[model samples]
Target: MAILFSRRKITAWCVAALASLAACGAFVPAHAENLDAPLVLVVGYAPGGSTDRMARLIAERLSPKLGVPVTVENRPGEGGRLAAKQIKRAPAGENVLMLGNPAVMVVAPLVFKDLGYDPDKDFVPVSQVSSYDFALAVGNKLQLDRAMFLVGRLWAHPEEAVFGVPATGSLPHFFGLMVGDALSVQPQIKGYGGSAPLAADLSGGSLPIAIDTMDSLYAQHVAGKIRILAVSGKKRASFAPNVPTFREAGMKIDADGWNTFFAPSTMPQPKVQLLATKIREVMQDPGLQKAADALYITPVVSTAAETAQMLKAYRQQWEPVVRRSGFAP
Candidate 1:
């Protein structure tokens, strides 16, 4: 038996299917259900990195809750701009997003002028993840009393001190610059490809001081291989409650680098709200918290609107810090 319908009848059937999804409430402010698109998460960094790990964590938990198949895609290079561009090109109704950090959003622009996308205009924030707390580490044989005292003494020394960083616009590099600016000295900085090389240099005493994140240095600090002087966090971290934060030391260099999830600039408000709401719910889960802690990350939960407000405030805050550090773009 042949089943056929007139053109008008087929159009009506298609319209009704979409209407049924809207009525089911699966996609937005109204929670409309749709068999239309799968939710996709785009990561700006290479796989095996923190951003990717975090993206997978959130996606795994958010899939069933959103009642859609969640897929993670890696589109690396250009320090996250590549992924950002991909997100921008996606259809507005498709759930496409990118996981990002300060390098893509804030630091790289200060150093590289030709970066193709604009954070403020090309993408919208979905969640503000936790700030990465940095630690000032030194080799064991250093003359300074501790990492903190060493920094103060190093600044006072007549010769410029040297520090190792992960990359030119990486958090460690900028943080070291900020610390030097605060101390009124321009320190020598060496940029390694990643954490492993930097650690090697630190161990070999070729690089005495390193400004690396707590998560990267926690294990070494516990094993007593490296000495931690000061932290970039506003408060002492739970794992290291004894160390002092930059604010506590009276310098007030609050450049705790951060990661925040984002979507294409044109994503509808209701869709943005729906996605942000789901991320917040997932981050709040105790099991997720434990998983993050195990991976040396801290879970941060916030609404998309709040994330936007925070970005605005942070841009204002970083302006002075960047200028003080002689950063020109």
Candidate 2:
């Protein structure tokens, strides 16, 4: 008779080995005392953007708490893959840390075949830091309902609506996919290198609609530069209460862009747990929450295991939507 081993059994064995190694102090504890090691926080965009600001904020708050000099390193190029590569190359047990997002972890690999690192396999997620909802900003070309109703109309519209996106596989790009999935209308998505170009094109009337962060939309909408048609959050944003969520509009759709921390996969579990725990602690700080609110972001916390589970679930939910968007890389 052939012997068979179940998947659970294999996982259990791996867990046991990791636990034993951790007890031996072979693994770096999450709260390792390496105060001199420069904790590099790598970001994928320019200094002024929301993502960069968030990274900086986290680094600032995390510095004193971790007793390390945390610094924000900007590597803004190639839709964040450059930063991802830089982190992947860092020596294990070093203080280098990469701020991972949906772009670097979820969508970029799907679009760029030559992506050198696998987020799911090459990096261990410490914790989910913050999240922001996206909005579909229309140019007042057509009067539409707030939130979900706008998505319905977009689905009903025969013409391919243009969604101005930041990068080819960034947050807005994925939001467009979910919109297309809900309404069954394939939106014509256009990618720009940065928000400046996107704003210019949208204001010039070349792009009729844009899928962007709530901050960008709220600022532009208030300035009469653009109009918000819908949002991709589960609930109405505090800044834009009139805008209904996809659930309220009778369409089941809710998604957001999240910022997380990831170290190289070879990182030990104890060190991973330590980082995850400390990040969760920092996320709950009232000061951090206030700072995050200013940027229209909400601090979210999750354990290392919980975040890993969340990533798996998100990938499962997005895979079909991505393939349908003709993202055949």
**Tens-digit lDDT string for candidate 2 (40-151):** 7788777887778888878887787778788998888866888888778766657666887887788777777889888867888888888788887776655543655465
Candidate that would win on TM-score: 1
**Model 2 misplaced regions, further than 4 Å:** 1-36, 145-157, 203-206
Minimal lDDT window, size 10, model 1 = 26-35
TM-scores of all predicted structures: 0.85, 0.83
Q: TM-score of model 2 relative to the true fold?
A: 0.83
Please estimate how well model 2 matches the true structure, expressed as its whole-model Cα lDDT.
0.75
Instruction: Rate residue 66 of model 1 by lDDT.
Output: 79
